[model samples]
Target: MRRPWGLALLSLLAGVAAIAVALGPLLASSGGVHGFAFSTIGVGAILIGLNALRRNRRAPSAGVLATAVAGIGAGAIGSVAMLGMLVTSPGGPTLLPFAPAGPVVAGSTGQWAASTTQVTLTSVAVVGVGPTKQVVVGNGGSVRLAAGYSFRSATSNPQLDVRLERRVAGGGWTATGIEATVAPNAPLTAATPAYSTTLATEAVQYRFASGTSASAPVSVVYENQHLYTGMAATIYADAAPYCPNTAVEIAHLGGREAGDYAPGALLIRISTAVGVRANLTRASQRALALHECSHERQWLNYGGSQEGYAQMKAAAAADFTVGDNGAPPIEHAADCGAMALEPNGYLGYGGFCTRAELNEGARLLNGQEY
Candidate 1:
């Protein structure tokens, strides 16, 4: 029997993941200094750890120390490399040189829509180029794309345009005629479109013709839909005004993933802001309001430090699944900070947990074990 290419790829990915998991602790200990370097180190560490652990208990060998040193050193190098990459171009900070929050630009298409994977086919419409990022889908049927996805076009008609039309479940590929032309190397602005659409959280694929140069289909992630509800309830139980009677608003910020304001609420940019609208889940809205309100409180109380911390928390909460409707995750550190601070029973991103459950979370944040 012949092995499928997908299976082979999966095996390779699994191997990589195993390596990453093993090295994660060492890399994490470095405080993510090497950006994705730790991830690579983690992979190496995992491979080493597994081999050592399986080799039967002995008084620890030079090999173990060697592996540890290698992992840490690699992690350090990765950190420096990532920092260099970040500071070397217009694309660093992801949200740095921040513009008013809007939609993220995907592929060469100047078109922006919020929902489902914003699949782009290079053959259909070529445009700008850089990272060639892709969209992330959410558990709630929302789709988000990272600003990293871009195209470069020096052609006379240097336009990056692609459309992600709705496809019938198990049907034909995305039709080619619906494609659009994207503006090249333009600063994303308020004039950007909020191309919003509803995504099916169930598994879906980006359909492009064979031999097309587009990247693979990235899934949207639906984070904490269940936990988000309970968290909102806990927050609104006390922080009512900010929690509003309705759900909070989320919008895609700019070429990069980020957040912004809306009428009486905040918008988490799911994809591009083109035709973007507030598509908040009942829980997501409440949690965001609480989260944003906390930001306001942080600004009033602690100033820059607290404000920065709050932003980090919001970013973590904003991380999406395979079909999330926001831009790629931003400010995850802030999210973790907020999670540590708000140790009540709310699962801000997912849903709710009992007071006991949340208390456990608090302990975990505080470095205590139940």
Candidate 2:
């Protein structure tokens, strides 16, 4: 009797295809190749074992029995691996049976709608305001959040309550007393009224929630105004677009340099002279901020502080000069990045950066580095 080699080969090919699919980033999410490979290999082994068992069933050979045992073992291992992967993978299928005794409940309502019903918070933005003339003179300010939500339901005119939540210091979310009701009557999409609140010293996290659904949180950092004043604040704000998360600080550097970035701390410290130079003209200030922020971007592009520092140190060592005529590669790259931000504006090291440096700076800013 001929063995079922064709079927076994097909199963093996299918396993290989599964592995390819898993490895392809566009093909799968969350679970990587290992899980898919293990599961598929186990299934293939089981199929091969079953084919071998059937082929010699009339007079079962030792080889057939061994193959069956091996197949069962592989299947067991694959099942375990698959279960672990699924359990750990976010938004993946579950093996546990979900048997509901009653209709699914959402929020406080028992109005069971089809599974198609969904409420999603789509967009969120922050608008900040300085102190008003009518208000008492102070350094404090306020910010208003505009949140938008979308809803869909199989049932007609399904309504849901959207709530704005802020993360508290206790690592839990609390409602900000901002709520809005949305239904299909309003065409299933609406923007909630702006929720205004006083600014805090630290950055705040906020999100919009509707029942069990929630939007991704946004962090509002007010450090630009709260931590900095005068020209420092202006420079920080100007540089913010280049590196939004990097913190800016004004300090006395005793004429060492215009500005310096601490990659480990993700902070940019500007010399008092830089701020003074910045106050001379808006273009100069913007150029200075852009240069410092470019350093932060460089750190980000090189991965993190450790790798960035190491690579930058190597580049600096290979360079000839740190003066305006010729600076280190890192400084040259930053100057080039500043040029990328303000192509027509005054750059401190404008004459030093080469065409390649300018292109590299632009590439880093655009996240096009391969």
Candidate 3:
């Protein structure tokens, strides 16, 4: 009996592909060991069945039949595992069939820590434009809430319910309706929409909930009421070590720019129209301000506007000519710097930063003067 070389080769190739799929991005993102096990078992069983078929092409042996049956059973289990991976991976397909009713009680126990920034009056400024006319131009700032969770679970699927709650006037906690279902074993970082406290002060709290178990409430107070004020305040605070005299103000940029930094004036100007837009969230607004502040640090490091602007222009022109990575070196540096200052909040850079740039950004953020 000539060995079925073609069948053997096909089985090997299919087995390798199956294993690759098992250990690929889906498994990496899910951070689940069960996925790997199921995938391995499924691949092994399928290979075993294929081998049995190749060896017993003419004679249907009882042992081959039993082996094939076992292989099928393992393959079914593997299919279920693959389905779970798809459901859990970020941006993966939704598990419409297995969707839960209400919040799925987390299968694992976890604890969460809250990160909050308070809105302050310093972010808002009242200026007298004329003898009798006064203009309020700075942001009134809002409370920003972000949570990081750590979980311990023995089960294959572990999820946690994260919620951001606000304290009402009567002191009762009300759900802000901002929530997310996250895997416990993975990097669990969740944030609520910035609470608008520009009209009045607000108390915001956050927690992690799982099957009637909840982490202790963590809270922060926001006490400012001007548009984009909190974002400006956050930028100023983060930039204080680098640019002590940094100032932020709301200005009309005529839709030409979201924000800009004036080197000599030490001013960060945020667009009024952009800030007031309904869809713009506070986190994104803060990210914009921080990006401008990075330019401010760059200017100070470069000595003055003459040197800084010249270098920036040259970099921009070169980037345009070469079509380098969609952003100029200066802009890329600023994006990295902003991310360094607010790792969880800033989402502008789209993860295009190099290691050297990221390190420089950290140094620039930490008062590394020219």
lDDT leader = 2
The residue-level lDDT of candidate 3 at 311 comes to: 71
Error of 2 at 225 (Å): 5.2
Instruction: Please give each candidate's TM-score.
Output: 0.24, 0.38, 0.33
- Residues 1-370 of candidate 3 have per-residue lDDT tens digits of 2243433444444454455555455453443454445466556657665776767667656555555555545555555556665455332322221121111213334233222111110011111111111112122222222223333232224334555455644476666676643442222223434444544344455443433344345443343423235556655565555555455666787765677764433467777765467245666665676688777666555544344557755643443221144555666677776666666555353546555666776676565531
TM-score of model 1 vs. true structure: 0.24
Candidate 3 residue pairs in clash (backbone atoms < 3 Å): 139-226, 139-227, 139-228, 139-229, 140-225, 140-226, 140-227, 140-229, 141-230, 198-225
- Could you give candidate 1's per-residue lDDT for residues 189-240 as a string of tens digits? 1111122224422334442322223433432222222233443333334334
lDDT of each: 0.33, 0.52, 0.48
Tens digits of per-residue lDDT, candidate 2, 1-370, equal: 2454444344445444444443433222333344454456556756665776676577656755664665555555555555554344322321211111211112325264434456655445432111111111112222333344443343323346667676744488888777643322121112222322345234556667777577666554434344557766787688766565555667887765777765433456778776455444667667778878777665566554344557755754454134375666667766776776677556565465556666766676664441
Instruction: Give the candidate number with the greatest TM-score.
Output: 2
* CA RMSD of all predictions: 23.4, 15.0, 18.8
